[model samples]
Target: MREDFLLLNPGPVPLAREVRTAMSEPMVSHRSAEFESVYERAQNSLDYIFERSSLDGTKTTSGGTSLVFNGTATMAMEAAVANLAGEGDEVVTVVNGKFGRRFKRIADRYANVTPVEFDWGHPVEPEAVAEAVSDDTKVVTMVHNETSTGLLNPVAEVGEIAEEHDAYFVVDGVTSLGGDEFLVDEWNVDVAVTDAQKCLAAPPGTSAMYATPRAQEAFDGEKAPFYEDLDWHLRKAESHQTPFTSAVPLFRGLAVAVENIEEEGMQERISRHRSQSRAFRAAFMAMGLSMFPEKNDESEYSNTLTAISLPAGVRENPDAFFDAVTDRSVSISGGQAHLGGEIFRVSNMGNLSSEQILRGVRAIGEAFHEAGEDVDLEAGMAAAREQLR
Candidate 1:
């Protein structure tokens, strides 16, 4: 890889120098006082992010405990489900993208799942979600930002429906928590999970979740997997520790990453992400590319990433186009699952600057040209510049 190689994938974003340096610090025993201090720092910084993660300055959470997992967000997702619901319980999972479906699959292992399904790339309807949830529903799960389709779901609206039924609301805020607005208390989210990668801009391996008192009261350790029992995790968290061994280096990196978020301020970070996303969208539109997802009144495009439909010329030979991009020392992702080769995705997550985003736009435009497409590179650049300004 080139020294100047750029990573524009949605998760595992390019880390800042300070975060990388923190991970390289001398290893310490997971149970040692030194490690516990690291854990405490990470947890405290995380609490700051969780409590202040609002897009419009209208919502913030308080009094919730943030817990870390040695595994990724998927583990946290499973823990949220397993600890709350069990065999005869009904879990209402709102599915509009891959992550939402994953939540349903996890819920299936422990409870009877009621899936409120929608077409991929389409907005999830809160009314439909309300129809699915009832007083008997033990829990309701939703993905805040569907990374697969670049659509931000109506989490607050869906959360309201779950609240009406008095169901435990679990949200996978994997891509939205740190980059966009997430109102845990105002949205009535009982538990919310996020990965160290994604919006946190740290290395992979570790994840975190926040649990409210209501959710804590409902936790059943005996019903959960031994390693995922929230009751045990919470008990251990009082000492700033996990139930088992922890990822020391990843936790160190996460501590610094959240510290970076604190220094930059949540409002400014969210503004940067939103601005960069708009720039990418404007650039793609100017080059005659359309976004892959459609939005309703309750939904909007994701602020962390942009997914564009592949032009006929590029879609016919997607590999060559992506190869061209790779040759430029920049990396972006293609659509996953059935949408593969149909769309391409780029992320503005983490601490990306305007220049890097502009370069990514130019690379995509050049790739289109290589694929025999008549995209206006200058026009795309101009549009991106306008948005950045």
Candidate 2:
């Protein structure tokens, strides 16, 4: 692998130098005061991210607690459902992509799941969600950004439906929280989850969630998994710690990562992500590639990752195209599940510079050429350059 290989996959994005350096600091005991201070620093920064993640300064949330756990966002996804819903309770899950389906599967384990399904790569309809949720529903779960198809779901619209029905609203903001606009309280989100590896640009193995007072009032400790009881997690958070032995190094990395976000400022970071994503889409279009997802009035393209359908030539031999990309010292992702070989996804998350985004466009264009496709490399580069400007 090249020393300067670039990562354009959706999660586990390239980390900042400071974040990488912080993770290598001498190992500290989880119970030590030093570690507690580290946890406090991370928690405070995360609070800033959660509250001030809006693209504009018009939206902000307060009076909620942020909890960090020793697992990825999937664990938090389960905790959100387990602690709020039980057997016989109905959970309305809006499924448009892989992550949304995962929420339904998790909800199925603890509650009766009612899925408002849509074809992958298609936007979710708020009217469908409104029809699915009712007063009898105990929970409503949605994925804010469906990374698989590069589509952003309508969280605020669905959140209003959940709020109207008086159900606990749990949103998987795994890919959107730090990179895009997420108005938690404004959207009536009771529990919102995100990962360190994704938008936070930290190392993998840690995740965090924000729980509103309403979620706290509805929490049931016994129903939650032994290792994922939010009630116990909340108690431990008061002292700036976790209920179990935490990943100290990852927390250190996360602290530095969120502090980096703070220094960059949420508005500037969000704008960068948006601009990069636009550049990616523009480049792909100029190369004659079509986007994978279809947008609607309520939902639109993801501002962190872009998914493009493969050209006929490349789709016939996707591995060769991907190999060409890797040969260029760049790594992008193929589609997941049934969409495999049909589409490729690239991420604009993390602290990537404009130069890297342009390089990614050039790499993809060159790879397509290598795969015997007729993509206009110069046109793609020019389109991307214009957007980056």
TM-score of 2: 0.98
TM-score against truth, every candidate: 0.98, 0.98
lDDT for each residue of candidate 1 in 1-389, tens digit (9 for 90 to 100): 56689999988799998899999999899999999999999988899888898776554978889999999999999999999999999999999989999999999999999999998888888989989999999999999999999999888898999988899999999999888888888899999999999999999999999998899999998989989989999999999988899989999999999989988888898999889999999999899888897444323999999999998878889999999999888999999899999999999999999999999999999988988889999999999999999
RMSD (CA, Å), candidate 1 to true, equals 1.3
Candidate 2: RMSD to truth: 1.2
Worst 10 residues of 1 by lDDT: 290-299
For residues 232-329, could you state the per-residue lDDT of candidate 2 as single tens digits?
99999999989889899999999999999988989999999999999999999999898886443323899999999998888889999999999999
Q: After superposition, how far is residue 253 of candidate 1 from its true place, in Å?
A: 0.8
Clashing pairs in 2: none
Report how far off residue 177 is in candidate 2 (Å).
0.9
